[model samples]
Every structure is written in structure tokens, then in C-alpha cells.
Target: MLHNKVEEVKSREDLIKFLLHLRKDLQTKGNAWENITLKDYLEAMEAWVEDMDGYYLNTNQPIPKQPSWKTIADILYAATMYE
Candidate 1:
């Protein structure tokens, strides 16, 4: 379900929908999420961006040189719970 949402994010509107899905997920399963507060989410986002290349390398995916809609959505979705 979440994977489908990630793949569906092609436009700004789709990005917004994915964000809403994140919100809903957090509301329903926040205890499982790492970053719940706004401060935590912001800090996690910064850290994630700093180490994004490592993430790609570890995942065996090519590093993205440009920011696409999916990349933006991935960052936002990760920031919600990424440690």
C-alpha cells in the first residue's frame, strides 16, 4: 500500500496525496514511527539528505543527481519517521 503510494507520486498533486497518506499513517501508527514531532522530523530530514548517497549505495540503487517528484515525496515520507 505504501509502496504503491510512493510509486504513484508523479505530480505535485500526487505528492500532496502521498503526504496525506503519511499523515494518516502517523495518526494511526505513530508509536511505530521514529520522528513524531516537528522538530524531530526536520532534524531527520536534514540528516537523511546529508546521507542520501549512502542510502542509495546501500540500497543498490543509482544515486539521483536531480530531484524528481518521486525524490521529493521520498524525502517527505522518510522525514515523517526516518531516524
Candidate 2:
């Protein structure tokens, strides 16, 4: 089930849609927001850094001097999901 959901994210647009769905799910389920803390916010930033590192290692691409706003938004959404 998880794999299928993951497989659906074939592009950045799909990912944004999925994250929006996840955000809605989290909201409807309740307490997801309540459970988040300052630490969680920091952890989300850490997750972004880790993700960037992994991307660099796996793709052999240098980090962009200026990451796109969409990329930053995606990272923040992912971090929130972790919380």
C-alpha cells in the first residue's frame, strides 16, 4: 500500500499533490499539529539537509547555489509530515 502510494509520486507536481493530501489527512486525523514542537521544526530542517546530501550522493550532482522555492516548500512539507 505504501509502495503504491510512493510509486504514484513520479514527478514534482504529483509530489505536491500527495503532500497536500497528506496534510489534509493529518489535519482530519487530529493532534498532528498538537504533537509538533520546536524540536520537530528543527528536525525538519535537518531532514532537508540530509535529503539534499542524499540527492547529491545518489545523483552525483552538486547542490544548487539557489534552491527553487518549490524545492524548499517540498522540504518543509516533508518535514511537517515527519512531525
Candidate 3:
């Protein structure tokens, strides 16, 4: 799942791979994606980042203390379809 892929992001190369995967996913499943427009995608990204710590705490995951490639990738990947 994409969640797994997002969790696996730890380096620049991984971020690049995740982005490529997102492109591929969009090409294959764009109909099912919610944030198709740039505006929606950016908004979702902002909202998701703002609430990311709460999500981690709620899910019993360690909250990221600093923004890293993984966190950035997670935000981008989530914004692709997150409501």
C-alpha cells in the first residue's frame, strides 16, 4: 500500500521513487484520486502537515521531531488522495 511506501521513505532517492510511484499511480488510477487539482493538492498538503503530529500520536507512532525526506514524502503522498 501507499502507506507502507510512505513509511519507507528515508532518503532523497526514496523520495524520488515515491514521487515516481505517485505519477504512475495517477496515470493508472487517477479516476479514484481525490486531489487531482493543484489547488486541492496544495490545500490537502497543508492540512495534512498541520495535523500530522496528532495523527502520529493517535496512531501510537513516534511523532517526527523535524521535517525530513520521509515526512515530506508522506505529506506529498497523502495529499494525492487525502480528504
- Higher-lDDT candidate among 1 and 3? 3
Flag regions of model 1 displaced more than 4 Å: none
Per-residue alpha-carbon lDDT of model 2 for 1-83, expressed as tens digits?
22234446656786676667655655676365533566876687677667676655675766756655444554555565553
Question: RMSDs, each prediction?
Answer: 1.5, 5.4, 1.2
Once fitted onto the true fold, the runs of candidate 2 whose alpha carbons sit more than 4 angstroms away are: 1-25, 29-35, 56-62, 81-83
The full ranking of all candidates by TM-score, starting with the best, is 3, 1, 2
Best by lDDT: 3
Worst 10 residues of 2 by lDDT: 1-10
Instruction: For each candidate in the order shown, give its overall lDDT on alpha carbons.
Output: 0.85, 0.57, 0.86
Give the per-residue Cα lDDT of candidate 2 at 79: 64
List of clashing residue pairs for candidate 2: none
Which has the better TM-score: candidate 1, or candidate 2?
1
Runs in model 3 deviating more than 4 A are none
Once all C-alphas are superposed, what RMSD does model 1 give against the true structure? 1.5
Number of clashes in every candidate structure?
0, 0, 0
